[model samples]
Target: MMKEQWVKDLSTIVNPQDVKIDEPLKNYTMTKLGGNADVFVMPSTEEAASEVVKYAHLHKVPIFLLGNGSNMVIRDGGIRGIVLNLSKLDQIRIDGTTVYAQSGALIIDVSKAAAAKSLTGLEFSCGIPGSIGGAMAMNAGAYGGEIKDVIVSCKVLTPTGDILELSKEQLELGYRKSIIAKNGYYVLSSVFELQKGDQETIDATITDLTFKRQSKQPLEYPSAGSVFKRPPGNFAGKLIQDSGLQGKGVGDAEVSTKHAGFIINKGNATASDYIDTIHMVQRVVKETFDIDLETEVKIVGEDLPTDKNKTL
Candidate 1:
């Protein structure tokens, strides 16, 4: 199908206002970097979302799901085909000690909601920056807690646009991995099992975690949180710091001096620069400690085409 015809059909099913052509994805990313999306679609309802999923499948068009734009970096050439963002579907509901959150709702917000009801078990997630979908996809963890501990079940869309409610056991969650990530399933919403706890205690824990995260992480600049995953029995930041790689990177990107785990966008940095900086850190860390650093952040999209006329 032609781009114009498919996009028009897409707009007809979902709201036209929710559809965009050649939309710059940089504005949606946490790092404020990325190229344009061929066709950006934000469906406010599950019905519309499913329709879009089927549409893409029927048309044999490529589809990519975007959550809150955390923990990912899109290259400069942008994404082709349909880029689905569920930001408009954000909704959170609380019933007793159970928290139900849509994929687009921020995990941090759900943590706050749980706290407001004097619930526990999610205190460790108060500072997690990704959406619920992303959290589920990655089995996101912080401090001493992980998503697998509290997740009861979740609604997900299969690659063929079929919806299923899966239990925690079915999720097959592992360290920074899940069945959803493994199979490319699209998250819709999730139910979490929390416990009633002392309001004062919950508040205190959140405060302490928030303070530590703020004081230690370079949150002022645009970054995709930690650039590399923690190696077994070792820390990525310690390795980068020990390698003397702090405060150095490619072009406008830099390995944050305040937090070596972060690669910050020092204004107008391209995705290529950020990726190269990550490679540099990996190479140095491997050379110094013989440890192969693996990236935690997901990198996607394509590189900008080089101009033949430009002199190297």
Candidate 2:
């Protein structure tokens, strides 16, 4: 738990009910494996969220910004200081040809909203399961499209609590990386400019992509969406499959037999189990192909100290 005075101070800025101490993070993450957070605050509005950030900055509390928790893994040792969850900030609005979404809005929900308005550019994101903020932070993509392709500008709250609207060029969006991520800025909202398209075409595109995702990815099990980024010219999944590690298992964590790219929780999987599996896959792939696999999933927090030293 955080200092009582700090918690009480933050409660005055955000909704009192939204504040929690020693909150388990597994329930919020996509992989459903993590320890607790010292303090968790879900602000209902952008202003409230900014206020929380300001308070943390003034008090010298380390603050972690949490979106939908899709492409991240919080280690077994609980995170210290304050964790700001943006889940309550979800709000998507359509204005003319532009779609505005609060940082906490799910990308799939934004795609659906755009589709309802016959917007064509966001079709590729219909199957993405991250929040708009996280997608922007990592320049998230799927099926040949990414956030960089459609985004115009975004509002962000700096670490020092200053809010600024940044253009696409300033965002410096690249393959699974962005300025927002490198600078540790908190995304407040994003504005996307999309073209008008036939409603049938938009719906069909979403359907086709949805089918591809459902068919190729292991959606049945709990796992972080793609364990590693596409390594250079080679696909991570293909490399792992070629290395004969498709069905590898470490405790309750297993490489998906259906898709080598994912490490799934086969019931009762600990964060350690998942981390070990990822390491095993990386080691095998590196040894066989001489390719260092870089992880797309963000692993943070401390590790649990154990007596056993298991080498991959």
Candidate 3:
């Protein structure tokens, strides 16, 4: 079947308005610099999301699940096949001390909701820019706390279209990694277990953390936060800074002068430029300190025709 036919069929299964053809990924990602996706689907409910996954699998089309796009970089050539977005599926409910959130629910929203309900454990996520699904997939952490510490369990849709509930132990979460990412599983929703705390304290903590993030991160530019994972016995930002890689640029992509860990898109940057800058930083850092820098941001799609076979 042709790509257009596939998109049309998907539109029939989902809402016509929810399906977009040749959708520009730049509008969806934080970097604001990617090409068009052949098909973009936003499912408003779990059933609709599951159906889209099943149909795409049966049709032998590639499927990519997009969260808030806070921690990802899509190539300038864009994505082929279907891009499944759960952005419209956002839903959050608080039951006692537990927070039930849909995959599309923003991490910040969840944190705010938790605080309003006097829940404490989620205060650490107040500044995270991604969705619950993306946070769970990477066991995202900040301010000395992580998702795994509060996540009781999560509902996931398998690649084969089966929905399964997984316990925290089953997630196998490590630093900036999780079993869901390793096994190619899609998170449908998550139930976080938090504690009752004083509302004043929670609010103050959130406020303090937000201020710290603004002071340390380069919020004025477009870029994925914290490009590299912290290497063992060392921090990625400290390593880059020590290597004198701050303010380095290739094209419009520059190593942030304020934060060495971030590679900011100064303006009109291509994926190749972003990636090349990353490589250069890595090479220099490794050669100078003998510490191999591993990326935390998920880089996807084809940047160049010749890079189709290259692994991110």
Candidate 4:
């Protein structure tokens, strides 16, 4: 729980105007179905973000580092103490063949910027919609290319507020995970080394990928992207389709008929509905194929309190 004093304290770390009390999380998330955040702190700089973390660490306050909410699901109870975001820090720079991007910058925008400069390696990520920080933490990839392939290094803040520059080898990126996630570090910025390439070829690749993604995915509705990870020797979408879960759902959340890999929120869906749909798919897949379906989405925040409000 966030106390009144904590709110005032956070204002000292950043601009008081940016410190919001009981802010609705639904406005920030892609699902549009979460409870209010107790205290939302949008810091403007890396130093300010570090100060807030250090304060939280010393005071034992529960804190959450919020992203742009493309790959996450926030529960109805919302977040407890402080929720920190670095949206104001968004900046992307291209110097020759290397790219420098702040943590809050959109990765899609970064990819496009790189392509504009005739950089080739980032074309694969042109369609990935996520913050640079989130992408770095997850080693975001698409179309047979991943962030780990071109990442040179990143500046990250440790859980205790110490800053460290991590090399790609130290990042330990593997299969939708990285050291940043394991150590709970907050990424400030990252540098990627790209190569000069033909401008026409890069643009063509992005166009083709964008088309394939739009045609195959359930882009009409809101979703947390692919719900489950690719299991060894098999794909999650194929397995879910084989299990006959498409279009089946709980409340307003349904397994997308267009793509079995995604669970879509068909307007007015609650987080509970979305989560239940995920469990339902997992249960069905397990029973049908005897293989566990590991979730790729990051499910967080608190469930609604048990009372009359509870509904299936």
Candidate 5:
């Protein structure tokens, strides 16, 4: 249980209204399945965010920085300490051919901003649902373009609350991983360098990618996109589909028939259903093809007690 005094103390660092106790986390994530966060804090400014992080560190409470929750699953038993949501800090600005985006700014929105300025190189991320912070943490990429290609530098808050500016090389961006993730650093903002381009050409590229995504991916249902990372020299989706695991599910969680890479919440699905389905797919793929499927989706929090005969 969260201590009342501890909850009240958070108000000293952030607005009282922004601090919540036993806050439901399901409302925050894409899948909309989870219990509660013992302490949920939303700071609208970088200064306030830093203060909160520092206070949590000083108090020895566990802290998790949450973005738009586009690629995560919070387990059924909920999160124990602080869950810092950066959604309120969204901001974006354009200067010449460079884009300055706050961590909370959506990547899709940033891509759109670049297009509006007639800047090229960001059209690839026009459909990604994640925020800049999450994108930086995972080196998020799509349609042959990754954040590393455009990012000039980033501002981040260290776990101990010190701010640092990291260049692209310093970020150590890789396929679905970065130094921010390895060190649990909190991204504050980023600068993306682009180039002047014809508006017609940029618009055409975005249109093409959007069509490809809508046609191939299952956007109608709720899911943490691309459940598993691509194994070296192989695609996770192809392996699952070839292994005949399509449409397989536990309860209401199903491997998307449209795209095998996705696991969708088929309405009334529990976190357990999603996890169990993931394990089932992994086990089947490994046994059938002898290739391991590593999860790309971030799974956090705790699970409900194992039920010998669980229902729903």
Candidate 6:
């Protein structure tokens, strides 16, 4: 399967407009960083998405499923193979007290939809920046609630392009982790069971939570949310703050002055700057608290190429 043949087949199967070559990743991610993607595809339907996956599997081309690009950081050197943007798969439906959302649907949108229907469980997600698929992959949570609490089941596309419906237990969701991510499964959609509630109460809750998030987080800058997972029995932000690493940075990537947990792109920051700042935070936190702060945000791709003629 040559690159040209694969692209041709994919274009024929799906719409030609949806298939793009050497697409810049900066336009897709929240951080507004990253280099170009060798190939980028947006599937308007599940059938189209499935076809793309099947072709990628058959060709042995690495397939990367991108959600809203909220919690990810691609390298300056860019990604190899195909980058599948699920943004076109956005769909939302309600049956009884359960809400079914496609992978590409924003979590906040889902929460708002639930609130409109007077559903009670998803108010916490109103401020979450990632898509539903990304949320399910990481069991995204905030304000004392998480995806695991509301999720009943999910539809996933396996690495072999086979679709499977998995129960909550099968997902094995944990603190910012799930079996889908562990097993390289792509989330297609999910069913969430919710309780009946007053619409006013739900809307109020969402508004309050949104305000809290805006006040605390560095929303003015580009960032991948909380950069480090909470260390056991302690918060990562507290650890970084205690280490005197707040407002510190490497290049343009700074430990957010508003929230030490976040590594923000102040202005014109490169992927290397972000990576360097992350490493610095980890080193200082480890030295100060004897705790190795593990990253919550996903970093992918190769490093930027340097000029061979330059000397150190």
Measured by lDDT, the strongest candidate is: 1
- Model 6, 50-105: lDDT tens per residue? 88898899889998988888998889998888888889889999987999999999
- CA lDDT, candidate 5, residue 264: 94
The stretch of ten residues in a row with the least summed lDDT in candidate 6 is 1-10
Q: Distance from true position, residue 93, model 1, in Å?
A: 0.8
**Which of candidates 1 and 3 reaches a greater lDDT?**
1
Q: How far is each candidate from the true structure, as Cα RMSD in Å?
A: 0.8, 2.1, 3.0, 1.4, 1.6, 1.3
lDDT of 1 by residue, 79-163 (tens): 9888999887789999998899999999999999999999999999999999999999999999999999999999999888889
How many residue pairs clash in each candidate at the backbone level? 0, 0, 0, 0, 0, 0
Candidate 6 local distance difference test against the native:
0.91
Colliding residue pairs in candidate 4:
none
- Provide the overall lDDT of each model, using Cα atoms, as 2-decimal numbers: 0.94, 0.91, 0.91, 0.92, 0.92, 0.91
Q: Give the range where candidate 1 is weakest over 10 consecutive residues by summed lDDT.
A: 1-10
lDDT of 2 by residue, 137-193 (tens): 999998889899999999999999989999999999999999999999999999999
Model 3 lDDT per residue over 1-312, tens place: 477897789887789998989999999889887888889999888988898999989988899998899999898899999999998878999999999999999999999999999999998899999999999999999999999899999999999778989999999998888999999999999999999999899999999999999999999999988999989899999999999989997999999999999999999899889988999999999899999999999899986577567888
Alpha-carbon RMSD, candidate 6: 1.3
Query: Model 5, which residues run further than 4 Å from truth?
Result: 306-312
Candidate 4 residue spans exceeding 4 A from truth: 308-312
- Say which prediction, candidate 2 or candidate 4, comes out ahead on lDDT: 4
Candidate with more favorable, higher TM-score: 1 or 6: 1
Give the residue spans of candidate 1 off by over 4 A: none
TM-score of 6: 0.97
| lDDT of model number 1 | 0.94
Shift in Å, residue 14, candidate 2: 1.0
Off by over 4 Å in 3: 306-312
